[model samples]
Target: MSGFERSETDEFARGARALVIYPELPGRASVGPEARLAESEGLALAIGLNVIRKKHYRVRSPRAVTLLGGGQVEEIAEMGRDLEADLLIVDASLTAIQQRNLEERTGLKTIDRTGLILEIFGERAATAEGRLQVELAHLDYQAGRLVRSWTHLERQRGGFGFLGGPGETQIEADRRMIRDRMARLRRELEEVKRTRSLHRARRKRAPWPVIALVGYTNAGKSTLFNRLTRATVLAEDMLFATLDPTMRQITLPGVEKAILSDTVGFVSDLPMQLIAAFRATLEEVISADIIVHVRDISHPESDAQREDVLHILRDLGVLDDEQAGNQPRMVEIWNKLDLLDDDRRTELSGMAARDDNILMISAETGEGIDAFKAHLTALIAKGNDLRTVKLRTDNGAALAWLHGRGVVSRQYVDGDIVSVDVSLSRQLWGQFEKQFENQIERANA
Candidate 1:
């Protein structure tokens, strides 16, 4: 038996022992095998799977039937038997035939990387939209694996004399069911997307800058969000602690208020199913004015993780070539600075000083947070136009709107008129002009 076991009578106990395998292929060495293996273990642990052992294999050629060589399959089977593992987790994509063959050979339930991620998502999805998306992705994934024979398919079904000749085969029937269900899920998700778009449109009309926080999983994004907004989101030291997007109103140093969105974290080779399913949620990031990319600087794979996030962002069209002119500006926040030694921290601080876009901070200890807020305020202000305007004292509504929507740098009341200096984005200025067309006496920058 494996070192970890659960009692038979424990109702809440999880008992499956898993063997994790990461296969390293030639010409694909961006991320090291150790980091990949560690990530695989984290995924397994996220869903309460007891990973008893893990291994990295260098594969010259992947087998079509089993994905691993015959000798490797035999060796892994023996290892599984020795450790009494009931589950085999391959940290690589596998075809339906390859998965089935491996499961049959090892006498253990086998799941590839995509399947494992889908399973974790299935378990972690909490919101109605999240659940619907997960179900759609799961159906799409399972539709490709309907190849097993069933005894019921051998039997004939009685139907209307003229309506049918023979009942559908088990695989065909299952595939049809999956397709129908997927269609329904897609319809539901479409409604979700439409509703989300409506909400975003409403926010756009209000015209507050939306700042989105995105990063690799467990990169202290949630922690930074909590520190910045004082909102009690679930910030845990685990992979994917926060799956759903959460937004809050945050006030920067010199900015009145902005919407801060904390989004789902990215990972290396994030499954396509997840990316497709979570498109609506990720759209929040797409429409942001500023993208704050939080990084766990203390992690050994931080650079690799950053590349993965950038790749995903590009794929999502947030960082696309076509949208380059209008794409949101990104700020790199090197978080977890408190974990580094004094010398390393000083080195990183010096590096950040040379780049205005990068800010080093420890979200847990509140270091550099003040500087980050100031930096954000300056970045936002840089896009606005400064103007001086005179308004009537009776136009209190317009004055309040100006204060609410823009930065009022100077204000003074003289008799029946008010003079103010304000900075406003082009969109906000356009709205202001439409609302107070006649109230303005004179305006100059």
Candidate 2:
């Protein structure tokens, strides 16, 4: 019952000392090892772990047993002992055998990047659906690592207290139990997905548009969300501070209202299990009419971070393979301007000036927020144009359709004719003409 086998309360306590290590592999040069180590440290701190020591090693060839060289493993064990650390946090995914070997050699509880992120999610998940999703993902992860990771699973148990036949290994019983629980979680999550689809459909029928805010973790997305919507979500400088999806109604210039969604941040090497488990929540991003990509302009790896976010968006089918503008309109927001110096800020402003779709703003200081709102309004109103149509008094269905799909500015009745002025998007306008061409007498666009 060691490590993850125990309840969370008895596992890693708050303020537990931790030794953070990053393995720098060959042919991986997107981000420097130092920056990646810093991010890993932030993740450790986010889970309330006291990072006593941090270091990185160049792994010319990763070892199958420990993922690190024998000498490197010895060095880490000695460092952990000297630092009196309670945990060893590896900034890479490890197999169950590799993890067990590392724990035996390092003499400290060991967890990898995926496990650490899962722990943070398990803690930060606020809503019931979030907890369920986390549990399902945790179960999925633990299902394959039950061999030597959990010592209690080595025992044999009888049928009554176990899951399988009369004489079954506890590991088998535990695996069976996990499978059953996972099946139930999938069913429950399916229901949640159905519920989300219903809500999305209802919003689709509404006249207002949907805008989603997406970015790297702790990239000032929640800050921008609060700044725009005036709702107090937990805006912290910690990784994964927000896990569940939050939505609010906001009014953009030239638009009465739009649904704004603040979703979980994206990261490099995001666990595939999490991506699959949280599909119900990420669907909000897929159905968004517009996507606002928020970036931490002050971070050194901002460009790399942008690529990571875009990669995830593409994975979610929000973007096409060609990326030839056949997807939702997207705008890149350069946030955290307050953290940049004058020279860097000026340089970025020059770059943004050349890009029509990029906006430089400080979400915390409200700098350029008015312009941001106006730009958002422009994107929303891009294809919509004003049209005046005269219809017969009996064409009630067409009038209702116009009201449901467009912004009806004016309507008047004269004799047997009704004149209506509406602003409709190009797609909606095309639908209107196709559906009600015979019902209208005259139309001017």
Q: Considering every candidate listed, which one attains the maximal lDDT?
A: 2
- Per-residue CA lDDT of model 1 for 284-329, tens digit only, reads 9998989999999998888889888988998898897664323448
The deviation in Å at residue 406 for candidate 2 is 5.0
RMSD of each: 5.5, 4.5
lDDT of 2 by residue, 120-141 (tens): 8888888889988888887788
Stretches of candidate 2 off by over 4 Å are 1-10, 151-162, 324-328, 388-422, 426-443
C-alpha TM-score for every candidate: 0.89, 0.87
The residue pairs that clash in candidate 2, if any, are none
Model 1 regions more than 4 Å off: 1-15, 149-166, 321-328, 391-395, 410-419
Measured by TM-score, how close is model 1 to the native structure? 0.89
Report model 2's TM-score to 2 decimal places: 0.87
